[model samples]
Target: MTDDQYVAFGLSPTSGKPEMLNSDIVVAYYDKDDGSFHAVDYSVTARSQCDGTYGMCPDERVNGRNDASVIGGERRNGVTSITFSRPYETNDQLDMPISRYSDPITVIAAIGHLNTRKEANYHDDFVTKSNVVLDFTSSEGNSCSTLVGGGQETPRYLPWPANIIPRGTTNFTATIGPTGGERGYSALTRLADSPSWGLAWWINDLLIPEIYVERGQTYYFTVYGGNDHLNSARYHPLYITSSPEGGFRQKTVDEQNREQVFAGVSYSKMGMPEPTAVGDMCEWRHTAMDAWEDSLTFEEYKDTLYKKCDGDLAGSLVWTVETETPDLVYYQCYSHRNFGWKIHVVDSGRKERQEGNNRGSTLLPTPLLASLLLATTRLLR
Candidate 1:
């Protein structure tokens, strides 16, 4: 047997108690060519909430489980997962260990790009990823390996990335890492409901990726929600509109007929970046959405929204809205109410609309414009 292999000594065959600990653990993928699981050139992370009672102490010590990381290091994309191999009972215990475990309680739970800096940005698509592995050691020289290989010493728990939603400010910047100097914030995932910032807002909530993010990636902010809900469900209608003759208007091809976007509010509209002092940048993040869940195809849900507009009608002004299932995220579209007729994200709003010589302005009601479309197109016919 391999040195890292697990040998169940006296474990009960039918014991649901598990031969190993239970925590966030993933089995690294091996190429089998050179006996290494090196595939993706990214880092992995595992997170478990602190279970201890309130009131942290100046000398409080804790630790993680070993069944956590069977094998953690470099790997492409992990296929075989070592689950429940980690344990999480220490955090809730009354007495903190005098010799706290090293690292987090969770095994390596996720893998992608390895970056110890910044905060997690959920803007990137993270469908293809791997989990983290926990590294542990036995109390003495004796060691037991389970499905998650084996190590020495006790297991340590890892913390989840902190989620940051920038509001009331134009930008959020800071330092992120074990060294403790967060400098950026990655807009990880969207909330079920829009996060209101009072006067300011996140453009279209059309985050940078909506996928796996790093520790801190200071995302640039612009614009306000005004009356529009940029952070809405994917099923909701959106506008890729522009302002004709300049500002916000309902015209794709403007008077000049240039293929460009309309500019939004002047520079004054943008809020100065949030102060870098303190931990303004997303140094930590808490991911609420599940990584694995059954979902509909992007095309399937898009068809439903198309039927609502009945776009093909000749005399009617038409716009396209693209979206995904669950309707909480993944949405895009175009609106006749825009000047350059660009693909405007509702959440990002005017901030993303800043393009071309055209400026952003209010559009006439859709009903009024629809009437004009019918009249003008019919007359031309």
Candidate 2:
């Protein structure tokens, strides 16, 4: 039974430098007792120089101090397919920081089993050839634009989590959101002030292209998601209630507090998935209900909001922008009212205005300039 189980190299950041200083190395396996797959980081090293012989030193253990997390994965075909993610930067001296270099980096991997004494042995053919050079780049099948949560002067950055699937597939999955760590995708401050925020599914943490819309054209994107920050603590599946004159108010479902009040404040009715329990994660996709409706559960709403797939907290969605024409085009979660991203749409008349400007420029008489240039050349001859 153990021979059928594979120790596969779980998913890593799909787009990035393989530089030891900028990326992470993940190894994953399955556990029969739990009936689930688990993963551990194999990237931390105490030695400044590695001899390329894995498992020979104390620093080579999988669960060292790299602080990596297994977002989510499944056991299929006797192989435990898992996805591993870490930050591109860190302050730890022993941990290797993922560098942002764009050049090619060499990668050497090996497969072996460890004994009860915690020692591993590799046969002669367990290593890669010296001629192999791995190229690390951003996700190719999808477009991505890196974004910060928000800031005042020097904006803070969130590490775009790596995904384990290609774009356009319904099965494309990822687990990226705010977490507690030095490089976690947390915002420095609330992004309520920016009239226009840069947000999108960064293809490989490399690019964020601008999306232009026309005034009267209707437009739509694939998905919108994020976590809620309450008193600096992160919560998922948060709901916000909106009123025409009263603005927005945050709400969540609680069993004990369903009809209870706290400190003279009453909780508004819960939204989708009526009877939502405390700490239950939720998210919203485009649905029949108006964007700011109060009811969390809808008969026709898309409830695929949180950063978890199949009960594991790591997922991503492909966000594609499509517009027919709009007065409003933005991406904001109900939980985060004062923050979200805005689309850049220009007036259709601007194209005609540019044409008129070009016509006016031709009035300068190019023939006269050409004649003057000819005379100057003749004089020189």
- Whole-model Cα lDDT of every candidate shown, in order: 0.22, 0.30
lDDT of 2 by residue, 130-231 (tens): 333444554456343433333343333343232221112222111223221111112211122221111122212211211234444433222223233231
For candidate 1, the per-residue lDDT at 278 reads 14
TM-score of each: 0.21, 0.27
Per-residue CA lDDT of model 1 for 24-85, tens digit only, reads: 12223333346543221111111211112111111121232223234343322322332223
Best by TM-score: 2
> Can you tell me which runs of candidate 1 are displaced by over 4 Å?
1-108, 112-120, 123-137, 140-265, 268-296, 299-381
In order of listing, the candidates' clash counts read 93, 28
